[model samples]
Target: MRNMLKATTLERKFPLLAVENGCIISKDADITVAFRVELPELFTVTSAEYETIHSAWYKAVKVLPDYSIVHKQDFFIKENYQPDTERDELSFLSRSFERHFNERPFLNHYCYLFLTKATRERSRRQSDFSTLCRGRIVPQEIADKEAAAKFIEAVGQFERIMNDSGFVTLTRLAASEITGQDGKAGIIEKYFSLSQTDTTCLKDIGLYPEEMRVGDDILCLHTLSDVEDLPGKVGTDCRFEKLSTDRSDCRLSFAAPVGVLLSCNHVYNQFIFIDDHAENLKNFEQTARNMQSLSRYSRANQVNKEWIDEYLNEAHSKGLISVRCHCNVMAWSNDREELKRIRNDVGSQLALMECKPRHNTTDTPTLFWAGIPGNEADFPAEESFYTFLGQALCLFVEETNYKSSLSPFGIKMVDRVSGRPLHIDISDLPMKKGITTNRNKFILGPSGSGKSFFTNHMVRQYYEQGAHVLLVDTGNSYLGLSQLIHNRTHGEDGIYFTYTNENPIAFNPFYVEDGVFDIEKKESIKTLILTLWKRDDEAPKRSEEVALSNAVSAYIELIGKDRSVTPCFNTFYEFVRDDYRRQLEQKNVREKDFDIDNFLNVLEPYYRGGEYDYLLNSDKELDLLHKRFIVFELDNIKDHKILFPVTTIIIMEAFINKMRKLKGIRKLILIEEAWL
Candidate 1:
């Protein structure tokens, strides 16, 4: 990790000699020197461990004068070096380079080791730098106070961007803050100041309070590098030692600047100049205002989706991190409180991908649809979409349950952080189902709640329009309507009825099985099936009917091997008889002893389980049934032992079969009194 912070400057050699207490160390100075020093906690100003640090400063010298050594260490230099800005130039340097160069250590393995050494050095020099007083630099260390003040002012002119408000990610902003030209130059000058003793002793040059006028408040802090390692030892502690709102410890120094201490205290502080003009504060406020404005929208919409793209693209280009988008759809219940809960929970996690009301009409209750960004791991997973929608749905439901008087048909993008609504529509494209001429309507209610009445009403209305109608009645309740419609209009040719008691409808292998078959027939069946399944199989039908149909289909697929043969009640009954006989023969049980009802009970599971799979699995076979929505029509069958389950099995199998055949039929399926 430490190596990740290596300097980009190529080596431009400068000749120098190491001196300890004014004595030269080594005569041969050809090699690059490494300095190891302790660093304050990241984003803080102090290292927990380490009194003084050790550094081997490398300034290339042609010859060295023999000198007593205070501290010495070996280091390696790449044979060739030049002073150009390239990472490779300092890639091989150790902690010593960071200390000598006075730059942030590279974030990599090498830099880690360098930080460790630097912290150790800081521990050793705790006493020496601690005694230095504020407003006083090490004597004879600097030339002009005004130049330093001007430089500090220039540094303060650099602005820090507000990351939370816009499309920018925190990590990207951090990298920018570290490497931008202004940031880099400030670091260099700060290091230069730290290297001078006179500059280091200046009280204002050390860590200055944010507001000097405060009687007991450390509002801010600044650190000059001259106060950090002025004695030329990486281990020397030249940091601000005492901190209180009171300026009582003006003379004491610690291992790190007061800015770092404030940082550790969770108080925002930076090593910038004190400008009474408040220009920096104004800029900060302006940037914040800009963010607030950009983040708001008239509706809950994605914040500058285009801007997000640009930000993510730039971040990726810089080899930073990843970004993604998420979308979800959720239905609302009558209870409004549930809706609000969903909104509160999920609306905060994402930039609203989309906000669609649950209901689009005044009479209908509202619902919600959300689209937001998700982590890369979440993309393409059905559950991810469900999670987003489910949570949001809960909130929307809760809100409606608690507060229903609000206008219902509104769409907006939501800011995840502030929960503010962005009213603009971010997703400009409208969702489309498909193109078709069929009319579809939903008649939803609990059992015995006039669902059939609603459906019959629609059928009557449509039939009166002179349009052809095919009544696929899964429930016998429709038989009365069929007769009524047929008798009312000698438009008898315009209506057709299919039920268990009625004539068997021919199965069309493909919706176009008969070249002239009306397209509306296929479309109606598809729409019906879509609705039934959308309700999660609560459609009314005898479980036995479903079983019988599946058993027949299963036996045909297993034996005659012609799945194309649509199994009716008789075919299924015969297949079950044969299979029962075979099983009895194998067990040596007399067929006379077998009870038909008991045997059927034994066979139900297979039909329900594996047969269901087969029915759903055969798309080609289902294509034949697309035009005919196979309704079990259970009203005439009084013996539920033979009727209910059987009807269910038949409808289920037929649905699976037709579903296999059906592709984009815009289908709706109805099951009246569906629960068993």
Candidate 2:
């Protein structure tokens, strides 16, 4: 069979005839194109977004005219093994033992591929008179001008949908073509070609068994079945063994080989061969007749009649369609020893899925039949093959649920159980109707819960995404993050404002720039003054509030007129002290009724030379909005009864003002320990 197959492929390039800009050209002048559909890191999408994605995919497929074959292949690699040549002083013995016995370290890799239909038309016109006389329909270019235009347009629509959905994809930039060594191309000759190698096992087939020397990897294809007891869903308990010894107590009752084939091209292949309804009914009737004929003979044999009767009865009652499914477990390794280890791991993983793999090594020609066009004959029929036949709904219902849980875009963090890098998408969570909610998150845990580490991770991701993050924290929680961001941005972005008694980080709320006295700032200053003077449980009179507002408004108007001088807390203090008396008299509030001296006394501490003088009396040099990341370390004043509230309110106002000024940028304000 190998010799016969070798004679068929007379092309130098085997299956690939030529490389084109948009598609691959095959030896038969067929035009085939491949694309990759990248799903978002988080498969969890809002209902509306799910609808949009589904609609887009449906539209893409619908736009293609009849006779177009769309092959979607998802290659899931769950593990990667790297051989250790130097394990101990006994290098040869240790290395050999570890390679065969030890569980190799692995990485999880997954990718999707979409192969377009192959155009079977001949590019060039035939000029032979005899052939023309026979009225043969000469094949045109594989994809004609009209079909190609539609395919391109559909592809563009799908790409836009993916991008809008926060997903990404890639396509082949150049055309790929196949060249045949012979005029005729065989099934195996299309994808595989003879390469010189020293391995004697495959030498007769004109190929090398030593994959390391040949630069090609071996693909072991297996048909998986008897999965009735296995988990029906994709991500549910797919891993059989826990990589961590401490987590040995965690185990699944039933598992699937969904993420088991680590570091190998594992394809969960399911083929739906929809039989004609009338033909199906006729076959069922014929089976019934055969069952009646076999009843007389069944009495002599020990055949379980009840089981066969129940099977046929359920099939008819459920109206199930015929569906064939098998998992193709493939491992590709250049090193022969490593490949053997991968194969063993794959087999063990399959057992956990209740699947015993019957190796297809002898029938290597059909290994890639599932991916190729017009090769459906290569797959074994459901009747002859060892397969599980059930209601079509049972099998097809789980098909749409085969998406991986890992986010498509994220940092690779190790999965605790598998020890494989799990790509986690730390982007904003999805809200209703496909809209992403604000990136506001809360971390609530005990003292030793690693809250700081988790917060730092999120902060770093936010900084990387160009978000303005302000961390109002105590106890130096974000000191390391601040330093890292500061170094990364070259001190242009991150600012760490640590408040100390000696070198206090001053935030003057009353400090207004020259010629900038807006109503908002005036109101902010009035609120701050009110908060400072009004004692707890002692509501300020409407008259007292009116007096304060009038005083601040008058000072702002007075300051606006003088562009040469800047207004600080000292300027406001002096103005309020002198103007409040006149303002109270104007409002018919006698001096005996309201003690204006009390307000003045309360404000003295935050004035030029008072106890809390450093806070509100200094110039406004630090601009919190301009910095991408800012950490206000308030451990010193965090315990202070008066200073803490004063500073917290001031910082909150600063962030609010900064956010108001910036129109479109996303900003985060993290007030840690708000209860404090």
Candidate 3:
């Protein structure tokens, strides 16, 4: 059987005729046009985005019924380095210092699309003659211009669909050219060269093997009985296993056995051949009829009783449904030891998943067949080859459900399930223009849920993107993050404000710069004062509230007229005590009716020599808007009766003022223990 299989698997090579814009024409006049697609950067893609991408592909295939589409994704490992080495050198003591501290491995992804046009009968006959005569391929131009135009239009439609979801696609220019030692030649040479082994040559037009030595491995599906329930989404169900013994200090986590190959550590290459739906349906109908006939014959003759009964029962249990698809899974590695390890690991994973896989011993023909179009004879199908078709095609590797934000500002974190570093963008959420909504986000979780850790990580990313971030917390959760950013920016970026009774961080709400006291600021100040003075279920009388508002308005006007006068809590208190009372007397309003003495007593603690006097009287020391990151630690003041809410209100008002001042700059205000 092996000898027969070998004889039947003759290695046939095709010559390349000419390379033109957008398409690669083979000697047999088969035109395969290729385009490169850029996958969106996202932590998890939303369901809507997924449906849109899927529908786009479906529509494209539906429009071009005669053309065959091949979608390919290639993932490779790239060593991480400082993005700007010169900038790093200026900051570091030496180049070696920077490399020693900041180098790691991350996965780089690339996606490509190939559309092959249907062959003409005349071209096919001529190609068969040329092959028999051992002559060059006859040059033939693509005859159907309308079909080509339609293909381009379909791609444009897809781009528009993706763009709405924040994904952009561009045409990969000269996709048919190969880059190597010879420096850019027709891709046909790499595929048709007789001197080199087929495994060493590049077969695909858009793909070039630069990082890893050019080679391929043929992974055949030996068993699928274990795949009784395929997941609705595409990705492996693997957990992260600790790679080091010291869990406390070690930061390495790798996927358990099988997942390592599919994740970023190793790359999995897939080539899927989708059969015609109409033909597949026809074959399934015929198979169903044959089964019915066999069942009737078995019951009538009682032949192989037990086997026949099991077959009939199985057929009755599951409805007749099947899909025709041929998939070739391959993994490439430059090192021989690594390749062997990957092959063994892949087999083990398949077994673990209950779907057995066999490494093809006839590597040359199998790998060659994977890249060639309309060549399915190399790998024959078995009875269990067909599967229940899914609504959406699976890419094997789980990707982010939605596209990443358009801005190139994010950090890569390891995905808990796949153990692949996923890019999490924290710059800004992409929303349609004219939409009115709050961008504030809340993180709620039980203890040890990594809420603080996640916030610190996100804040760090925002700072890296040049956004000003202010974090107010009761615990010292951000101290470590602050120090890290401070060191990286050479003590020029991050600032920490720790508020304690003995050494309180001063913030005068009434202190405003000249020309900066807009009505919004004044309103925010009044709101803060009201929050401080008004008790729950104890509303201040309307007259007293009006008096306070008039005092605040008069004080703001006073400060605006005279730039030298600094308005603090004392200034407002004096104005309410003397000027406000005198005006009320003139209006014939009695002091006893307004309860003026109580309002003065409620506000006296925030004045001179009061317990909270330091906060309301002192000048502001930190510029919240200028610094990249500022953290106000309220650990010492969290339990105070009056200070907690007052400090929080002050901080909130200050941040609001800063945001108002910096209109064009993006700012983030994160409040931990916001309920307090």
Candidate 4:
């Protein structure tokens, strides 16, 4: 046993030495600066915007010095939603909403970028010389302090270039986040254990020729290491047909198939090794000459020479920098059956990108070691294919999963790919962040396309968060939700009124909760009466308009003085019939100028015992202001001239009144399929 070829442990071959001041130092004189990458949400960026992100990456990578390694590692781990049910302030629907998502599994993604400056000797090392294969560790001295300083400065510039694009943001990782504390695992520890959570305990790692295993989970890796396996022509973005139509194209990054679209617990590692441009060109030129010399032996050699010449010509003419690039997807599952399914899923996803998936078996350990946050210098060069910076950047995914809004006000939405519930703020947060100009939203779809369904979902959440929601829907789309709220509040809120022969929708325009009539309130009341009395084509006479305004003013004044008299259309009609007629007679107004009898008869339907006598005298006026969810369903009477216009005016007046009383509160008025 002692003679078993000097058994070496992972601790002896680990490439990283220590983390200091938020930087990772390696055993081979490599220093890596780490950052957490925040990308735009999936399905949100357009084709032009994708080019901006790609250009940002291209420019950012151009700022780094020769022999620098840029490694972007994205972890898509399966996680469950942990709802906080302990909050006491949650409403009944809100608590149920939270519970509905509890334990719901989703692929949680976290992206990281590592900028590593490797020593010249280490930069040129091959796969056989990786730390995983070497038992004796030889530490390289980092003698050039100025080079490290310059590299850090260049990294800072790289960050600025990416951030200034306004689409991508990079945040520098803190020391604690890189190398965590007692209970939490750091970035390096997480890689070693293949754990998604920071609080996971370190587990044992087993490496075999067939696969790699971390505790109970077995790994499956698929790599795009050779140019022969990649797509013939790559671009900044591709058309995603799952969420796109022929008329409307949805654009995503070229490598999106292997990104958030690939569900499961996985990691995507992208590497671009920036070697000396002149040196790589010289080597390629030398290789092309060799291929030319061997052309007499085989036609393949002639073809290879032509390809190399084109590469050299493009590099020299276009001033394109030569870089070595590699990308691979690593997935794992605890059950063998699930691991097989994950392997198939990964392969199919790669196939979706028009690439032949190569199931990588060997070099798994070394590749995993190189992905250690700060140890990017230890990556195997043999696994990478040579490409230009622009083409290499095309393979980078520019989007991530939708993150929940931090603001308290938002609607509950599901992620398109993951189906994870996301707290999305389509109104306030977008306006606050300057992402949108206003809170106005316009939804367009054919029938049965869930247009009203989405609006119902939105308003329900709005109502739960102390918002006053006034819905004027022609159909009964909001009936169930309004009923839910109505039952939950026990008839105190969520008032839903639909026109029926037995019981019609009604409201009191004259009743204000606070009994204070501002100019706008009085004007709204006047507009309601005007809408009721005159037809759409018939314009009221000037004298009649003035007389109606005076009557409303007089009734408002009488109610302000006397608390016993109710402030509704009944009292106002009676005051106009008996008291106002006597006043008109005293003023001796002529019958042609002002007809009191005609005015009373026109508005008499809303009076005590007429056809719509129950319209304006509402006992529910006080609670209307406090009601958070109010739906006026006019499906039956939307075509009726009297009920439709009158009901809309009354509901709108109530909304206006609520807006005045509830000063800083949120109020939403959604009108769907009205007058349809």
Candidate 5:
């Protein structure tokens, strides 16, 4: 009767375990905790049978929450100390088993849910900042202008068709399609398939079951944004998660679910997209294996006939493959070559130690180029390019080591491409008469460094070399050089000074294209006139500048480049005056009430471009100093804006094509403070 009662009770607690020693539940559940166990409990019936209890129960308990408790008795009465044959053992076992079984599913469920939420949260933080920006939409303001009206109309049309949540929903759906199971599976099979006969299923989700057999750890590989396409090529569902988006070139981390670190080799075949990633690990193993295999095949000074010789001979039979392998073999053939050469040579040694001459025992080329001892007499006569260069130019040698070898030291060549020959006397070097190599030297010394004294000596040297010296007396500092050259040479060959008084230097932007016009260039004659009148503050009224610019544009079309014929400038001014006359004739405006004098009153409203007034613009001119020389000098004219065009045009018109016309004339146009 008791047996029947106990059996009935046991059956009620776990229906699946009644016929077997244990029950196994295979349902999927959310695993919330950080760890897990395969089995939850064990039970034994007798005192001695307690030994039959498996350790798995104890191990499983280790993973449970700290608050959980286990009891040794159930249906507690005041003092029931039953022995193992004691009813208490069975009671304790039963209760413990029941507790573990019930809690296992709950723990698994929570763990699963925890992981899912964590993964989603991690992915959200990786998205671009632009996604967040869309949440903060602002209404744009529109003005009453034509451009603003068009912008408003466009914005309204866009608002009518679009809703606020549309962008978010589209992005979510797109992401889902990209990471779905079928998509992941196809990509994996495409990249990792090794055999023609093995069929890969589309439901695997880019993850081969064999690759994720581990339950303990995960492996992650990171790639830059430029390589995100790799996951698709590899047939995997793994994706790049952005590390940082604040930078323009963000890198993403790709997590690969490798279950166990030890099983890397078994799943190595899955690395199909790039062999390099897998090869590095494989190479390390291969290299270790090869070295071990090589040692086993070689012993004492003899190669193992069966192992080493046979393997090498077979490899050498395949022509090109043999040649390549032979090179490697030769590289390792140091026993017969390098060691042999080292033992035979001694005279090659350049250094001695402890009063003993050290002999070189190797034919290996010493990487060292040359070294000269303190005794210059000991230098080699059949010198290397390095040594010969040092000897010829009397340069010092500094030893530098090269490559991996230590025997032959290296020397750095002191001669650089920019360095001049050190020891050779400049007087001994050949020279051509009347041809001077020292063109000009700019002295950049601090004040009180005798810069003027040095310059005077250089000037005297040039004069002795037959150069006609022309010293510019800027700041009046070069008067001494001028007097020296004057005292040395007479007539037109001597120094001369030039000064001017009545040359009116004026600057008027109204007479140029905002002062960029070459006044001598009649092509922009209208621009020059307008610029001039504007600077004079005598510009025409609002009706004037507009009417004038329009008429100028038309006249330019009428005459074109042919406007240089003198008739153009006269016509432009005539057209300006006549336009106002015609406007007065039509009664469109009045000239008497708003004459040129009163025109300046409303001058600003009519101005088209920037405004400026008349000032003397510096002009550059080349003054003929001698038969073969010219001095360029600059003076102010109407517009400073005319600096480039005026300087360029004047130089071109006066000296360029007209050089041949000046008979035996040497002209030099000198510019002072030339950057102006």
Candidate 6:
């Protein structure tokens, strides 16, 4: 059954020779060192920071030798989230959070950089020939070891330049990572197999006129090879509208549209070819003259010459390095129908970048062949256009997905883009790092803008993490959360208080736990009495103030001495009106200054038989220091002149008591609608 036609595998015509010490040596003697790059998290960088990152790249790329290729490849693979449900201390809400994103899919990214030194002949090669087009090519030997050593030193400097910037880091890939070993796939294998894992086996690559397919997965290539497809202006970063506001802005890298937004299995390939700077500028100058000579014959020539002149003027004026650049998004899917949809996604993503997407079917095989780890020297020269180094570096995707905080004390938050759960330590670690001096946060937003929603989520998790949380809110924002905790603890916590016509919020001003009346407690009782007795225009006289202070001290001693007597505002009111009134008369206090009858008349509404007797005669003890979660719902009485200030004073007393006693546990107090 032998046929006369010849058949060969990709391995026989493969351009790579061997991988040594994490460096790849190619058949054309190209030496490439690979590194795994770590960039800043997405949505965290500002516009000014983006420019700094671009400048860092400029300094890093300038150190490389002439004719070297800088290939930065970003891989975004669609991966389904697998929740970890085995943690022992997970609360009910935490467990539910795990289930909510059980099978959610997100685009996981991995970035790698390859710095290659190519031969002059290989750098000038065209798309007409490649290892896949011709027969086997013999590997060449490097005669000058000193030049290679110098390049390695320069690469070390390149790595130093990037790491010193504080925004990006580069880790050199190990030998085991560059070439597969011990059942683990390497970068080269992942590129050929189009898989994010080590389990995928090599597939057949079919190069047809209509499409390019690797195994059952069909490839979709979109390239920005021509300058006509580029926008008129470029910048370091662009504005993100989803999370931006008129008062504030959120910035992402300029190439972000084709980055995480594309949402598929794709590789963004960025190439920078470092040619001799002076020689390249001279060549452009000569081409500009040629265009000028043909301007009389065609108006198009005149416009082309002006453009070339502008490019030359900028390069000379700024001392810019002219380099060739090419970018492509190579996506693949096993389903042909899905491949068509991915093609459209890729095109639209490029359009978002203000670029025209060119589906290059004819050059698909060549571009794919050139993407292999050390084989970048075989890239077609015609596919790239010349631009300055600064302009080319702006197109890099300088962001990554969010990272979880390391501290144990934090709130559970969801990643906006991935829907994955994140533990953010906004309080503890921030204080340690000096990012914040204290954990006091002020949230401001218009109504219905999720301000209350986010605060509710934060306080709930904080309570679960053993924090004492007290909230004073005018709206019923924490009702559901409070109810959940209340039921979970079987009414042991999550205490909420609200005022209504049928039932009003009441407190015991004369009650103090542990049978201790300190100076602060005595002062609070005096303040309460003054507020009840004095009008807005009336100021208490000196004699009346001393009389009220004496009344509070006498009642505190009575409660301490007599255990059978229940301590409450009613008992204190009775003591001040009866027992203290006779003592005040025995001391012969002036009637006009003390005004006992007038005080009783003003406070009669809060006495035992008064209309508002329930306002201060509660027996609940209000031991808020022992309670871990408590909320005071003040919406019903926030506008009432009598109740709002009284309720606020009582709430502040409870919080101050808890803060003074519980020193070890974390505490949070959120005040909602506090304007009133």
RMSD of 5: 38.8
Error of 4 at 485 (Å): 3.0
Give each model a TM-score: 0.21, 0.66, 0.67, 0.94, 0.19, 0.87
Give lDDT: candidate 4, residue 52. 88
TM-score of 4: 0.94
Clashes of 6: 0
Global Cα lDDT for candidate 2: 0.52
Candidate 2 lDDT, 107-197, residue by residue in tens? 3333333334433222111212212122332323453677666756665665565455443454433322122234444222322322211
Candidate 4 residues 1-676, lDDT tens each?
A: 4564344567777777888778888888789999999999988899999988998999999999999999999998888888878999787777888899889888888999999998778877888888877877787788898989999999999999999999999999988888888888788888877765776576777777778888888888899899999998999999998779879999999999889989889999999999999999999999999999999999999999999999999999999999999999989889999988889999999998899999998878778777888878888888999999999998898899999999978888888777788888888898888878889878888998999878877887787687889988777888898888888778888788888887777777787767888987888888888898888998888988888888889889999999999888899999999988988899887888878888788888888889888888877665677778888888898788888888877787778777777898988888886334
Point out the worst 10-residue segment of candidate 4 by lDDT: 1-10
In model 1, what lDDT does residue 591 have? Answer: 35
Candidate 1 global TM-score: 0.21
Model 6 — which ten-residue stretch has the worst lDDT? 2-11
Q: Pick the candidate with the highest TM-score.
A: 4
Candidate 4 at residue 521, lDDT? 83
| Stronger candidate by TM-score (4 vs 6) | 4
Model 6 agreement with the true structure over 131-172: per-residue lDDT tens digits: 777776888898667878888999999999999998999999
Judged by whole-model lDDT over C-alpha atoms, candidate 4 comes out at 0.86
Q: Which regions in candidate 3 have their CA more than 4 angstroms from the true location?
A: 1-14, 37-84, 88-103, 118-324, 334-336, 352-354, 369-406, 411-423, 427-429, 432-438, 480-496, 524-534, 557-566, 575-587, 619-628
Error of 3 at 478 (Å): 2.7
Give the winner by lDDT: 1 or 3.
Answer: 3
In the range 168-283, model 3's lDDT, one tens digit per residue, is: 35354364343223444432333333112223344322122222123342222222212333232332223223432444322111112332334323333333334454455565
